[model samples]
Target: MKIDIQKDWGKIKSHFRTCNRRNMHVVISSVDSDQMPTVTPIGSLFLNDDQTGFYFEKFATKLRKSSEQNKNICVLAVNSRKWFWLKALFKGKFSDYPGVKLYGELGEKRDATPREYRAFQRRVQSTKRLKGYHYLWKDMAQIREIKFTKAEKINLGKMTKEL
Candidate 1:
């Protein structure tokens, strides 16, 4: 069933938070000019209250090229914590939706504003002490906006029926 993106924005945000915590990244797929699909794992996607979000545009060459050709994209976030899945499997049902897909179009790429940069820092604060953190995220300067038009809950037979 289709999820009402406007009405379920909060739930969607929560699911993404869980996904980031459990999986550390979300998968984004876009089609190139030749209709070849490209997928990228983005660790910096952040959702806003208004059914929109942005991701830092760095280190994703294929995604950048594909977005240039076709703005349309799909983002998938799955709560893949081992415990969550084991519990669901034992109970024969999921307490909540295990995953969600958002459909949207990419907007203009621009420099990250102060507010956005700060938010990104906060999100990665726990990894700040690590050397790779500085190497990977210290210079996240560009971002691409996404205006989500639709959301769908991933269905897994009877395991997701309650959700």
Candidate 2:
């Protein structure tokens, strides 16, 4: 069902946070020059209060290439935690949305501001002690902005009928 992206911004933000934690990343889909489609898994997406967000562009080579040609993109965030599913299964209904799809267009690709960089650091601070953290996020200096236009709550039979 259609969601009022502005009105439900708080819920959207919470859902995305849970999605990143449970699923590790959100899937971003874009089209190439020939209308060919591609999907990129991005873990650094952060939503602002104004229905806009950005993602670190360090390793998304294909997404960068495709975004240059086609700026339109779709982001899918799913809450796939085993306990969430198990609870819904037992109750025969979901208390909250299980997923959401965001429709947006790519904006400027620019260097992240100091504040943005700090936010990114905070997001990944839990993994700072890991060996791969430095290898993966040490050089995430650039970000591509996204202005979201619409949101759709995922529908799943009677499980999500109330939502």
Candidate 3:
């Protein structure tokens, strides 16, 4: 279904939050120079208020390369919460969408602002005690912005009829 990014921004952010809470990675799809499709899982995507978002660029070499060849990218964020799915299954309808597809064009790689950095840190603060947190995320200093063109609800036949 068509989604007004401005009007449904809150719902979009909520969906991302739900998925992020469960540590579900957002899948970014892009096509390479040779027209081969590539999908990359990213854990650091953050949505902003004005139809713009960014994701930390650490360890996303493939994504970066693909974006360079083709700026157009599609990001899929699914709420993988078991309870949410179970409730939907039981009720035969979803109160909200299970996932959304964001169509956008990748922007230039830039140094993340301190505010952005802090926000990322805050998102992962609960995992501070974990060793891998420091190794994997502490050094995330670069980011690539994305300006979304459209947002669409992922519709599954029969199952998502009421969404």
Candidate 4:
């Protein structure tokens, strides 16, 4: 669908904030044997936004671990559906979709803030975080950029685009 990407980020960001059990898209960038950049999908990213870069809690999966070795990444996320997600990705690049992305390095830190601590507790107790969370964030390396795509084409079958 043709889209005008001007006023869709707010709606998309809201969706990411309230999602549960939804699979978020991740693009972990690393060097191949030849030292060229390689990107792939890694599941387990959770959105935590307050007033800065959207924070994500990730376990040590192969993708995360591999990315950790390189410290460069560009992650993507969108509400999933048959029609909306027609392609596994957009335009063969990181910023091709109407979603939020963070381009930077990775660092670890405690999920120690008061509000986050309680939320973590609830997550663990509610069986939401699976094995539970330990060092919270993993800092956003550099949080190089964070933004959303336009809303004119974010369709989900019967759900009209939120333009």
Q: Pick the candidate with the highest lDDT.
A: 2
- 1-163: candidate 3 lDDT, tens digit per residue: 7789889998998888888787558999999878999999998999999999999999988889888778999999888888988998898888888989999999999999999999999988888899999899878999999999999998976777776
Task: In angstroms, give how far residue 114 of model 4 lies from its true place.
Answer: 4.6
lDDT order, best first, reads: 2, 1, 3, 4
Model 4, 1-163: lDDT tens per residue?
A: 4343334434444655433235534454555445576666643344433222323344435434554456555554555544434553442322233344444445453344555445434544544454433344322221222232222333433333332
* TM value for model 2: 0.96
Q: Model 2 over residues 28-120: C-alpha lDDT tens digits?
A: 999988899999999999999999999999999889999889899999999999889999999999988899999999999999999999999
Query: Least accurate stretch of 10 residues (summed lDDT) in model 3?
Result: 154-163
What value does the lDDT take at residue 107 in candidate 4?
47
How much does each candidate deviate from the true structure in C-alpha RMSD?
0.9, 0.9, 1.3, 8.6
lDDT at 88, model 3: 85
TM-score of 3: 0.94
Flag regions of model 3 displaced more than 4 Å: none
Worst 10 residues of 2 by lDDT: 61-70
Residue 160 CA displacement from its true place in model 4, Å? 12
Report lDDT (Cα) of residue 117, candidate 2: 96
Q: Give stretches of model 1 more than 4 Å off.
A: none
Model 2 off-target regions past 4 Å?
A: none
| lDDT against the true structure, each candidate | 0.93, 0.94, 0.89, 0.42
Q: Judged by lDDT relative to the true structure, which candidate is superior, 2 or 3?
A: 2
Deviating ranges (above 4 Å) for candidate 4: 1-12, 18-21, 24-58, 61-69, 82-99, 121-163
Q: Give the range of the ten consecutive residues with the poorest summed lDDT in model 4.
A: 140-149
